[model samples]
Target chain A: MSVTRAWAWLIALTATSTAVAAIGLSGRWLALVVLALAWAKAELILNRYLHLAQAPNIARGFALGLALFMLALTSLAVAIP
Target chain B: MTTPQASVLDDLPGDLMMWVLILSELAVFGAGLMGFLAVRLTDPPGFAEAQAHLHSTGAGINTLVLVTSGWLAALALEAARAGRRARLRALLAGAALLGGVFLFLKAQEYADLWAAGLTFESHAFYTFHMLLTGFHAAHVLAGILLLGLVGWLATPRAVEAGAAFWHMVDLVWVLLFPVVYLI
Candidate 1:
């Protein structure tokens, strides 16, 4: 993907996540949605910005680590009741 | 003979040491975020209350600033490779300018929080807020210096390494924003 396209998506995703929170939404579901958006933004930076997509192994490793962290975050969010 | 995988590894972009630094920074921020959540789990209401004091809108603006700065840095890399020294310097300046904007917004947010009587000693939430985001702010400072240095040098390798570090800053904020302000 082109850098411009990746940047546009990054802006859109940032807006969406910000809007979600601005709407006064709170709960595990909100955490899940926002955190998922965060992961997507990070992926765009990793691939399009950092050019990690050219290094598939390294890219995949970072993706896996981010996924696990997000999962743990979700679990913690759910448990926060 | 070198295997395909070995060749692919060798093909990784930029200096290998930059990747090492990127990985280390990510690990540190990731652990800090996880620690935040663990502490919040122990006192959800208190955490939520402290979080409410934060300026999420300003942080959201900072996110856009950082991402746009990252884009400029990426373009700067292209310009450097194309041997367009003037354009490379201009792009790096633009990216660094946005970094300045981000820092300005962050300082404003910090001032507001301070005025509101939120300090590191107030609670676990405020403490993490100070440490994690303060650490990140320090990185932005470093990244700006790196961008300036690379632009002055006008070398492709310097540009590549500098841009990589700038994007690392952007990537961390993308995650840290939600964890600290929104979530």
Candidate 2:
């Protein structure tokens, strides 16, 4: 993707999260959506920003690490709650 | 222009040292977040109430601002790859300027907290709130300095390393905004 397109995605994703916050969902639902969006945004930056897409293995590692972090965060907040 | 040549591992960008720094920083922030979660779980009501007093709107806008800065840094990296020396410097400067804006907004938020007399000793929530964000803000400061240096130098490797660090700063805020303020 072009750099411009990548930036557009970044802005759009941030807007979604801001809207979600404004809407004021709480507890596990909020946790899930926010963390997931954080993961998505991080992934986009890893690929489009860092140009890690060229290094597929590294990108996958970062993606998996992000997924695990989000999962751990969600489980800690939601499952135990 | 730096071609973003893969490292010996063939899966990394920029210097291995920068990635190491990024991961180390993330680990530190991650540990802080885990501590925060533990505290919040113990006292959800107290934590949520404290969270309610925060300027979530400023944080939300800051998230956009920081991400936009990351986009600029990414464009700078692209410019480096394209051998556009002037564009690289310009984009890095823009990214650094946005970083300044992020700091300015955060300082406004901080001023309000100070005016309200909240401190590191105020409460468990505020303690972590200030600690984590304060540390992240320090990183942002470091990033802005690096961006300025790289922009001035206009060298590909410097630009790539600067972009890497700046993006790492942006990534942390993106993760922390919800954990610290909204959620």
- The structural similarity of chain B in model 1 to the true chain B, as TM-score, is 0.96
Which stretches of model 2 miss by more than 4 angstroms?
A79-81, B1-8
lDDT of 2 by residue, B1-183 (tens): 777765546557788899999899988898888788878888888888788878998998898899889988888887887999899888888999999999999888889888988777877999999999999999999999999998888878989999999988988888888788867
Q: Tell me the whole-model lDDT of each prediction, alpha carbons only.
A: 0.93, 0.85
Error of 2 at A13 (Å): 1.5
Model 1 misplaced regions, further than 4 Å: B1-8
Q: What would you estimate as the lDDT of candidate 1? A: 0.93
Clashes of 1: 0
Scored by DockQ, the top model is 1
- Using lDDT as the measure, the top candidate is 1
| Candidate 1 residue lDDT tens string, A7-47 | 99999999999999888778887898999999999999999
